[model samples]
Structure formats: structure tokens, C-alpha cells
Target: MQIILAATPVVLLIVLLGFLKLPGEKSALITLGATILIAIFGFSLSFGDTALSIGYGVTKAVFPILVIILMAIYSYNVQVKSEKIEIIKQQFSAISKDKSVQVLLLTWGFGGLLEGMAGFGTAVAIPAAILISLGFKPMFSAVVSLIANSVPTAFGAVGIPVIVLAREVEMTDQITLISSHVVWQLAVLMFLVPFLIVTLAEKSVKSILKNILLSVLVGTVTLAVQYYAAVYIGAETPAILGSIASVVVIIVFGKLTANREVKDSYLNFSFNQIFQAWSVYGLILLLVLLTSPLFPFTAFMKANWDIFQTNFNFNVAGTLHTVGIYWLTDTGVLIFVSSLVGGLIQGLSLGSLFSLLGKTTIQLKKTVVTVCCLISLSTLMDFSGMITVLGLALATATGALYPLFAPAIGALGTFLTGSDTSSNILFGKLQATVADKIGADKGWLAAANTTGATGGKIISPQSIAVATTACGQQGNEGVILKKAVGFALLYILIAGIVVYLGS
Candidate 1:
């Protein structure tokens, strides 16, 4: 009875959002209400404690999470308004008349770069749009982009997902350990990504064999850089550096393999134009690095911004709630500054930048509500001990088989929430708890929650919606979902098996 009651919110979420096809925002609100009731009555949590959790959760969703979305979308809008997006598209198209090569570069290389910088669904949406503009069918473009985004996802948005998982598990000291485990677990996916993309795009495994060398080289480069960055550098560096390395290697390979007779004019863009278009992203990277723990001046920044910190703590029903806010040092601030600087470099006036920001905020109104409500629901369940109860049940039932279900739980979190970060936020602690109970490696299991979330990226309704809209096939979400679900399943299965063995 306790297990069933504990799982009621999650089950209802899956039913409403996954099966009934309800809007996420609506479902989130309904689930939030349900969670509050359960927390207050069923779990004996005081109303005050539940309300504090809600406030904490909503605050978190608003600051870095929702603010990141607003900034990323605004940055993209600035590029679009300035027409730099078109130039970037033309430059990619000129690389190869071979539609397959173009698709691989744009979707795998370029898309991976975006994922590293912004994450969420920007990686899929932007690349799918680029592929469509380059003449690929909307559905095909969406499918390939979705698949390509998976390989780089764990480290996406500068490793926020992994960092969040570490914090939630109360194992911040073991972040490097968790990151290493995640990188090793993802090694299989990295090597398979190139081959998988070719198979998905061409609808034939034979094509992967035909282009075996290119596929092998691309995969090798991706895996090598991803491993090095995640292990040696920092969590935020892996996807960015890995994707960049893959693109460079692929381009060099393409140049070498080309028939001697064909000259491609795609490299014709002036260096200045290219620099302007890419400078904003460079700025973001620089800022992230500067503010990152890796930088020498990080201490100075943190000390100077102490005044901006906000802390709240309360006790209700024997539960302790402590939340902290660091406004000045938030990643969102860096992203927003980078967006503005990029817009200026692209020749947008100050007024225009503010106008675009306003529009983006309005557009994301529903997203704001959705994120807040969902986060609140997750927090309430957590504080109410519902999440712990569920995790305990799973740990006991699975026993030695717990590793096999690790990725499944991760995939379920993402499939319901449609965001890897959200999935980690919801289930990372739960995974940690289960691992502790089962005597499994806590870091490995926590990291698995994130690595596994990547598999659900293609099938997420939010991702499908973004892909369809970007490809100018807004109402064709069902078609894209049906086409992508098979790939999603295979990816998750492979992820689960790999994690099971690793554990």
C-alpha cells in the first residue's frame, strides 16, 4: 500500500502526459496538486513544509533553469533576426553536395556543439531546421537530429545534468567519480553514434559498412575527446570539446576522400563573417570557463558576489528545508550576458535585443508554468518521503537485478518530463538511495540516471514538438514520434545492458 501510494503521482503523470496526451503544463499542475495532497495527508507532512518545498522548487526552476531557456532562445532569435543563421546554413551546405555528409556534419557535429552550450532541446530543434533548409525531408531531418543529440547529452549545457545529479545525491565530493563512470558507460554510445546515424538516415545498415572508414574515424574522435574532457578537464568541457573535435576530424576526412575533380565553394565565407556568427558561442564558453571552478579567478568572483546570495531554512513536520540562491554567479547571468554581447556583435541595437528578450519571455510563459509545477511536484514527493519509499521498494524487489533497471528508471524520468536535467533532478537522489540500499556503487547508479536519460530524448513529446516546429511540420509530431520510438528503444536497451555490465 505504501509503495502504491508513493508511486501514484508518477503513474498519474505517465498516464496523463504519455497516454492521454495532455499538455505538460496542465499535467504538471494537476500532478503538483495531487502531490501536495498526498504529502499533507497520506505522508503526515505539515502543510507548511509542503509549501516551503514548493517555494524552493519554484525558485530553482525560475532562476537558472527557466532563465537559461529564455537566454538560449533569445540568443537564437538574435542570430535569426540578424540573418547570420542563413549564412551558417549556407556554409554547412557548401561542405558537401552529398546529402549524407551534410546531414552528419550538421546534425552530429554542429548539433552536438549547441547541446554542449545550451542543451534542453535546442540541439535538436536548431539542427533539424538546418537539415530541412538544406533539402532533407522534415521527418528524416527530425529523426536524425534527435538521434545525434543523444551522444552528447550527458554533458550538455556544460554538464549541468551531471552536476545536478551529484548535488542531489549529496556526493558532490564524488562528482569526478560519477563523471568518470558516466563517460565510460557512454563509450559504447559514442562509438555507435556515427554508425547509428548513417543507418537511421539511409534506412540501411549496408550504408554504414560502405562508409566504414569515415564512420570509424568520426566515432573514434568523438569518444576520445569526450573521455578526455570528462575525465581530465571538467564535466562542462566534454560535450563542447568532443563535438568540436568530431566536426574537425570529419571535415578533414571529407577533404582527403573527395574525388580530385570536385571543388566545393562552401568554404567561401569570409573569416570575419564566420567569426561574427560564432563569436557569441565563444563568449559563452569563455564565460563558463571563467566562472567555472577550473578558473583561477573563481574565488574572487564568488567572494565579490557574496552580497547576492540568498539562503532560506525552515523545519516543519521534522523535515529540514534549506535553499540557497546565488544570483550574480548563476550560469543564467553568463548566458544572458553572452547573448547580449553576441547580439551586439551581430549588429543588433540595444532596443532590438531587449525587444527580442521580451518576446522570448512571453513565448515561454507556458514553459515557465510547466517547469515550476513539475519541479514543485518532484520536491513535494521527495520531502514527503514518497520518493524514498518507492526507491526502497525497487531496491528490495530487484535485489541483484537492480542494475538492469537503472537505465529504465532514468529513461522513465526523461520520457515523462522531456528534459534530461529535469529527469536527473527528479530521480538522481532516488537512484542514489536505491544504490546505497542494494550495496551497488552509488556514483555509478547516479550517473546512470543521466546517461540513461539520453535514450529518451528522441521520443520525448517536447523534443518531438520542437523538431516538428523547426522543420516546419508542426502538426506532424505523431509521425516523428512513431518514427523515432524504435531508435529510442534500441538506444535505451543498449544503455541498460552497458550499465548493467559496468555495475
Candidate 2:
């Protein structure tokens, strides 16, 4: 009964969003209300506790999550308004006429770069929008972006997910070991996702054979770079450097294989014109790198500015829940600033820039409400002990076979919370405990949690919301989810097998 009650909200959400094809905002709002009722009556949670939990969740949803989505869309809007996206599309076309190669470069290579640098949905939102602008179907753009966003998530936001997992499980001393385990667990998928996205884009098995060499090259380079970086350079730079390497390889590959006509198109643009067209993204990358973990400015800001950080504590159902916000370091602020400056550089006036931002906010209002409600639902479940009950039940049921199911647990957390880092926090310690009970390597299982969370990102409603909104398919989230769920399941199944064998 308790387990059923704990899972009711999730079940209801799936039915409404996945089956009934309801709008995300309506579905999430309905589920949130149901969750509140369950928490208050079924779980004996007080009204005060429920309210506090909702507050914390709303704050979190707005600051880094919704804010990031808002700004990412605004940045794209800035490009469209300034007519730079047209030039950007032409530049990509010049690189390769094959849609498969274009999809591979944009979704797999460039999307991974965004995930590594800033994450928080920039990977899915920015790249999906760009793909749509480049003439891909909206649904195709969203689904492929979601798929490509998966593997890079383990090291996203400069490796915050793994770093948080290490901290949560109190294995900071073994961070290197844990990072290596995560890369290995994700090894096969990292190499194969490029092929998956390309085939899906081309809509044919023949496309895989046709582009086999390029796919293999991309997969090999990305996997090798991530493995070495995770093992030697530490967790902070693997995704960042690996993604950069993927981009470089694709460009070089495209150049060497270019037809005379394609080469002519590439030559039609001056270096300055190309730079101006890509200036928005360039500024975003530069800003992200400057404030990334590799830089001293990030540390200096956190140390010198008290207002750069915000933390709120809520006593929910007798437990303390703290929501922390890092303002200055947030990807949203960086992207927002970069887009504003980039727009100005592209000849847009300040008035027009603010006008674009306003329009963007209006366009994404439904997404805002949906994200907030979903986050609040997750928080209520956590505060009411529903999530713990579910996790423990799965661990106990699987027992010795828990290794095969470890990634599923991580995926569940990400599905509920919509973040790889938050998923790790929710289940990292539980994974370690289960490892001890089942005689598995603690680090391996803990790392599996992060790896699994990456797969979950593919189907996370928060992720779907961002993708749909970016591609101007907001109300069709269910259509996209229905298409994406199969890939997400396959990803988790493969992850589970890898973890099981490795364990």
C-alpha cells in the first residue's frame, strides 16, 4: 500500500503526459496536486511541511532550471531576430550536405560541448532549436537532441554530477577511481550514440552503412578522449575537453571529404562573416570556460561575494531540506549575458534585445509552470519518504542481481528530479549501502548511479519540457516522449548490463 501510494504521482504523471497526451503544464499541475494530497493524508505530512517543500522546489526550478531554459531560448531568439541563424545554417550546410553528418556534428558533437560546459538543459534546448532552424522536423530535432544529451551528462556542468556523487557518498578521496568507473560504464554508449543519432536523422539502416566511417571515427575519438581525461586529468574537464575534440574531428573529417561544390560553398564566406554569425555561441563558450571549474575566477567569486550564493533550509516532515543557489556561477546568467552582448554585437539595439527577451518569456510561460509543478512534485515525494521507500524496495528485491538494476535506480531518481546531480544526491548513498550488502564494488555501483542518471535524462519531463519549448512544440511533449521513451529504455538496459558485468 505504501509503495503504491508512493508511486501514484509518478503513475498519474505518466498516464497524463504519456497516454492522454495532455499538455505538460496541465499534467504536471494535476500530478502535483495529487502528490500533495498523498503527502498530507497518506504520509501524514503536515501542511506546513508540504508548503515549505513546494517553496524550495519552486525556488530551485526557477533559479538554475527554468532560468537556464529561458535564457537558452532567448539566445536562440536573439539569433533569429538578428538573422544570424540564417547565416549559421548556411555555414553548417557548407560543411556537409549529408543530413546525417550535419545531425551528428550538431546534436552529438556540439550538444555535448554545451552539456559539458553549462548543462542545465542548454545541451538539449540550444541544439534542438538550432537543428529546427536548419530544417529538421521539430519532433526529430527534439528526440535526437534528447538522445545525444545522454552520455555527456555523466560529466556535465564540468563534472558536477560525479563530483556531487563522490561528496554524497563520502568517497571524495576515491574521486579519481569513481570518475574512471563512470567513464567505463558509459564507454560503449558514448561510442554508439553518434551512430544512433545519425541513423535516426537519416531514417534508414542504409544511412548507418553509408556513414559508418564518420560515425566510427566520432565515437572512437569521443570515447578515447573522455576515458583519458577522466582517468588522468580528473573529472572536471573530461566532457569539456572530449566534446571539443569531437567537434575538431568532425570539422577535419568534413573538410577532407568535401565535394568541390561543398568546398565552394565553404569558400563563399569570409572568416569575419563566419565569426560574426557564430559570435553568440562563441561568447557563450568563452563565458562558460572563464567561470568553469578549471578557472580561478569561479573560486575567487565564491570566496569574495556572499550574494553569489543563496541557501534556504526547510524543515519538511521532521527532516531538513536545503536548496542552494549559486547566482553568479549559474549557466543561466552567463548565457543571458552572453546573448545580450552577442545580440548587440550583431547590430540589434538594446530595445529590440529586451523585446526579444520579453517575447521569449511569453512563449515559454507554459514550460515555466510545468517545470515548477514537476519539481514540486518531486520534492513532496522526497520529503514524504516516498522516493526512499521506492529505492530501498528495488534494492531489496534485486538483491544479488542489484548490479543489473543499479542504473535503473539512478534513472528513476533523474526521472523524478530532472537532474543528474540531484539524482546522484538522492541515490548515491543508497547505492553504496546496497553495494556493501551485495558484495559489489562500492565505487562501481556508485558510478553506475551517475551513468544511469544520464539515460534518465533522455526521458525526464523537465528535459522534454525544455526540448519541446525550444523547438516550438510545447504542447506536443507527449508526442516527443512517446518517440523518445524507447531509446531511453534501451540505453538504461545497456547501462545495466555494463555495470553488472563490470561489477
Candidate 3:
């Protein structure tokens, strides 16, 4: 009875967000409030402890995400005000003449770029909008974009899933991260699979999936370099490194392909055009690099912040957890600086710049709130032990098939919440602990969990929302999810089989 009621919020969230097309923020708040009431009266946790637990739950999530979200918002603002992002997108003009390459590049390569730089479904949303603009049907654009977004998720935001999983599984340092680094880097290589499909659809796939071969060949090099980075240099930079590597690969491949075919269209973008358009992209890369371990960029950037932080520890009904939370200006500061820099470079006024920020905020309010609420509720469930209890029950039900379900569990968490990092937090440690108790290969199990979770990226309600918004199907995400459910499930099953075979 306790478990069922305790699990109500999650189940409700899934159904409401996933099925009913309810707004995520409202559902999360309603469900969270209900869970709190149950925890207080039915489960009999004290009011203060319940409140503290909720606070702690939200705290764990907010710290890491705040900067990420703020960076995304600011970066977006910079893109719009400076017109530099427009210049970058202009590179796709020649390709847009062919729907196939349009889908392939924007949906796959561009998707990976967004996933690497600013994950959390924006990859899907932003790209879907571009695809829609390029003349694809809205639903198809949403579906393809959703599918394309998966490959880079394992390494999204600099391999955050593995990092979260590593910390949860108690890996203090290098030993914990190498394999995960390899996993995500490998996932980056897998990105080519979707690209090949997009190519096939484009009819430019040469009847033999030629682009796939090229992608795979290039992916191999990217993965090889990324693995080296993870094991020897640093796991933290895998996404950034791999993305840069793949971009170079694509540019080379483009040159080779164009040289062989000698298409006049490819020759259109002049040196000046390339320079003007890629400036913002270069700046984006610069900002991200500054935040790398190889540099003191993030630290230097963070130094300008005025942060309000609080730490608290507690024993809640004999269960213990500690909390650290921050309201920092780091991400906001980066965005502010970037916006100013980008605007100045593009010749925008101070008033116009503020207007861009305002418009971006107004547009993003619902998205940010939905994301924040989901994090708060998810964290609360985790901190309260409710998620563990429910997961244990589900794990018992799966029995020997737990391996298949492991990633599914991660995927399921992501499906509801729409963030892979959040999913890792929800299930990464729980899966590892179970694998150990059951004597499964820890590496294989970890891989399965990660792989399965990546598959769920497509069907996720939040992802659907991003896709719909990007595709301009704003209020009809549920329908988009329905169109996508078939592929999402197919991919999920395929990933499961792959994990099972490897295990």
C-alpha cells in the first residue's frame, strides 16, 4: 500500500505527461504535492523532514542543471541577436536543395552538435524546427529529429550520464570513468547509424547505404580518439573532442564527395560567407573549451558569479542524505557575456540586447519551469527512498531478464523526465547494485543500462515536447509521440538485443 501510493507521483507523471499531453510543470507540481501529502500522513514522515527531504531532492538536481540551463538560454539569445547562428545554418542551404541530405545533416550531425553542446531535448527541438523549415512534414520532421537525437545522448553535455553514474557507484576517480567514457564515445560513433538511415530516406544513400559506410568509417576514428581521451587524457572532454573530430571528418567527407561529383551547389558558400556564418559557432566552441579541464576557463568564468549557497544534512526517519544547493550566476554570467559579445559583434544596441533576453526568457519560461519541476520531483522521489523501493520491486519482477530491463529502467526514467542525466541519477546506482548482488558482469550491465536509457530518449514526453515545439506542433506533442512510438520501441528493442548479445 505504501509503495503503491508512494509511486503514484511517478506513474501519474508518466501518464499525464506521456499520454494525456498535460503540461509537464503542472503535472509535476500536482504529483509532487500529492506525494508530499502521502509522505506526511500515510507514510508518517514528519512535516519538517518531509519538507527537508523535498528541499534536498530539488537541491541535488538544481546545482548541476542551473548552469546548464542558463548557458543554453544565454547561448540561444546570443544566436538570435547576433544573426551568427543564421550564418551557420546557411551552410545547409546547398544541402537543403536535397531533402535527403537536409534530413541527414540537420537531423543527425546537427543534432549531435546540439546534444553535445546543449542537451536535454533541445537538440531535437532546435533541429526539428530547422527540418520543418527545410520543407519536411511537421510530424515527420519531429519523428526523424527525435530519432536522430539519440546517438549523441550518451555523451550529451560532456558525458554527464557516465559522470553521474560513476559518482553514484562510488568511483572516486579515473578507474570509474574510463569505461563510461568509452561507452559514450562509442555512442558518438553510433550516431552514424541514424545518419545512414536519413541518407537512405534521402535516396542519396547510393542504394548501398554509402553515407553509412562513410559515417561508420569516420565514427571509428572519432571513437578511437575519444577512448584515448577518456582513458589517458580526461573523460570530461569526450563529447567536445568527439564532436570536433566528427565535424572535421564530415568536412573532409563533404570535400571528397563533392570533388568526386563536382556539384556546383557545394561551391556556393564563399570564404567570406563561411567566415561570417561560423563566427558564432567558433565562439560557442571557444566558450565550451574555456570550461574544459585543460583550461581554467569555467573557474575563471565562475569567479564573476554572486552565488547563494546552502548546505544541510539530515536523518529522516533513520534514512540519511546530505544536501548542497546553489543559486549561482555562472551560467547566466556566461550567457550575459556571450550575448554582449555576440551582439556587439553583430551590431545590436543595448536596448535590443535586453529585448532579446526578455523574449528568450518569456519563450522559455514554460520549458524551464517544466524541466525544473521535473528535476525537483525526481530528486525528491530519489531522496525519499521511494524510487529505490519501486525500482527494487520492478527489479524483482524482471528476474533473469533484469539485464534487458536495466537499460529500460533508465530509459523509463528518462522517458518520464526527459533528461538522461536525471535518468542516470534515478537508476544508475540502483542498477549497478542489483547487478552486483545478482553476479552479473558489471560492465555489461552498466552498458545495458546506458544503452537502454538512450533508446528511451525518443519516446520521452519531454522529448516529444521538444520535437513538437521545434517542428511547430506546439500543443500536439502527444500525437507526435504516437507517430514516434513505433520507431522508439523498435530502437529500444534493438538496443536491448545488442546489449543482451554483448552481455
Candidate 4:
């Protein structure tokens, strides 16, 4: 009965969003209300605690999460208004006329780079928008970007997810080991995603067979580079370096295999024009790298500049949660600044840029509400101990087979919270504890949580919201979710098999 009660909100969300085909905003709002009621009555959480959790969730959602989504969409809108995205689309077409090749380049390569650098929602929003502009179907573009965004997430935002997992499990000394475990667990899925992207784009088995070599080459490159980086370099640089390598491989492969007409089309653009069109993203990358943990500037600022940071503390059901916001160094701020400067470079006036930002905000109003509600629901579950109960129940029920379900717990956390880092924080310690009880390898099980989170990302409502907003398919999140859920389940199943066998 307790397990059933704890699971009600999740079930309600799927029914309303997937089966009822309701708009995300409506479904999230309804499910959030149900979660609040359950927390108060079923879980015996006090009203004050429930209210505090909701407030904290709303604050966290607005700051870094919603801020990232807004800036990503606004940046794309600024480019569209300036006609830079048009040239950008032409640049991609010039690289490869084959839609399958283009899909791999944009979604798997460039999308992974974005996820590695800035994460939050930029990976899905930016790449999905670019794919739509390049003439892919809107739903296809959203789903493929979501799929591509998965594996890179373990190292996203300079490996914050894995870093947080280490901290949560109190095994910071073994981070390199944990990082290696994560990449190894993700090895098979990393290779599988490229083939899936190509097949989805071409909608034919023949297309995948024709581009089989490219897919195989890309998968092997990403996996090998990422594994070496994780093992030798630590967590911060694997996704960054791996994605850079993938992009290079794809460009070189396109060049070597190009027909004369395609080669000429690629050469039509001037270096300056291409630079101007891509400046927004380039600036974002530059700014993110400058402030990333790979550099000392971020550490210096955090140590010396207290004024640039905002921290809020909330006590929910006897547990204290701290939410921090870095005003000067936040990726969303950098993205917004980059977009403004890039827009000016493309010849848009200051007033025009501001106008576009305002319009973009209005366009994403529904998305903002949906994300807030979903975050609030996650917060309520956490503070009420509902999520812990579900995790413990699953561990107890599985017993000797617990390793098979470890990844699913991680996936469930991400599905509820819409974040890999948050999922790690929620379940990393629990996985370690369960592993010890079952006499399994604790580090491997903890890493499995992170690997499984990549799968959960596909069906996350917050991710779906970002995708829909990016592709101009805002009210059709249910349709997109229905289409992508199958792939998400398949991904989790594979992760489960790998983890079970390894254990």
C-alpha cells in the first residue's frame, strides 16, 4: 500500500501526459497537485514542509534550469531574426546532402558538444532547433536530439553529475574509478545511439546499412576516446574531448566521401560568413570553457567573489537543502550575452534584440510553468520521503537480483527531476548501500545509476518541454513523449542487462 501510494503521482503523470494527450503544462499542473495532496495526507508531511519544498523547487527551477532553457531558445530566436540560422542551415547542407550523415553530424556530434559544455537543456534545445531548420520533421528532430543528449550527460557541465555522485557516496578519492565505470557501462549504448539516429533520420534500414561504416566509426571513436579520457584524465574532460573528436571524424569523413557538386556547395561560404553565423555558439563554448572547472577562474571566483553568488536554504521535513546561483558565471548568463553580441554582429539593433528576447519569453511561457510544476512535484516527493520509500521497496523486493533494477532506480530519479545530476544526488548513496547489502560491487552499482540516467533523459517531461519549445511543437509534448518512450525503455533494458551480467 505504501509503495502504491508513493507511485501514484508518477502513474498519474504518465496517464495524463501520454494517454490523455494533454498539454504538458496542464498535465504537470494536475500531477503536481496530486503529489502535494499525497505528501500531505498519505505521507503525513506537514503543510509547512510541503510548502517549503515547493518554494525551493520553484526557486531552483527558475534560476539555472529555466534560465538555461530561456537563453537557449532566445539565442536561437536571435539568430533566426538576424537570418544567421539560414546560413547555418546552408553550411550543414554543404557538409553533406545525405540526411543521415547530416543527422549524425548535428545530433550526435554537435549535440554532444553542447551537452558537454553547458548542459541543462541547451543540448536538446539548440540541436533540435538546428535539425528542424535543416528540414527534419519537428518530432523527429526533437526525439533524435533527446536520444543523442543521453550518454554525454554523465559528464555534462564538466562532469558535475559524476562529481556529485562521488560526493553523495563519500567516495571522492575514487572518482577516477567511478568515472571509468560509468563510461564502461555506457560503452554499448554509446555505439548503439548513432545507428539509431541514422535509422530514425532515414526511416529505412537501407539508409542505416549504407551509412553503416560511418556509424561504426563514430561509435568506436567516441567510446575509445571517452573511456581513455575517463580513465586517465578524470571526469571533467571525457565528454568534451570525445565530442570534439566525433565532430572532426564526421567532417573528415564527409570530405573524403563528397561528390563534386556537394564539395563545391560546401566551399561556397566565405570564412567570415561562416564565422559570423556560428559566432553565437562559438562564444557560448568559449565562455563556458573559460568558466568550466578545467580552468582556475571558476575556482577563484567562488573562493573570492561572494557577491556574485546567491544561496538559499530551505528546511523541508527536517532536512536542509541549499540552492546556489552564480550570477556572474552561470551558463545561462553567458549564453544570453553571447546571443546578444552575436546578434549585433549579424546586424541586429539593440532594440531588435531585446524585442526578440521578449517574444521568446512569451513563446516559452507554457514551458516555464510545466517545468516549475514538475520540479515542485519532485521536491515534494523527496522531502516527504516518498521517493526513498519507493527505492527501498524496490531494493527489498529484488534482493539477489537488485543489480538488475539499480539502473531503473536511477532512471526513475531522472524521470521525476529531469536532471542527471539531481538523479545521482538522489540515488547514488542508495545504490551504494544496496550494493553493500547484496555483496555486489558498490562503485559499479553507483555508476550504473548515472549510466541509467542517460536513458531516463529520453522520456523526462522537462526534456520533452525543452524539445517541443525548440522545434515549435509546444503543445504536442504528449505526442513526442509517446514516440520516444519506446527508445527510452529499450535503452534502460540494455543498461540493466549489462549491469546484471557484470554484477
Residue 396, model 4: Cα distance from true site in angstroms: 1.4
lDDT of 1 by residue, 322-382 (tens): 6666665566677788889988998989999899889877877766777688767776776
Report, for every candidate in turn, its global Cα lDDT versus the true structure.
0.75, 0.90, 0.62, 0.91
| Better lDDT candidate (1, 4) | 4
Candidate 4 residue lDDT tens string, 399-501: 8988888999999999999999999988999999998887999999999999899999989999999999999898899999999999999999999999999
Best by the TM-score measure:
4
Candidate 4: lDDT of 332? 95
Q: How close is candidate 4 to the true structure, as a TM-score?
A: 0.98
Pairs that collide in candidate 4 are none
On the 0 to 100 scale, the lDDT of residue 197 in model 2 is 83
Q: What TM-score, over all chains together, does every model reach?
A: 0.83, 0.97, 0.80, 0.98
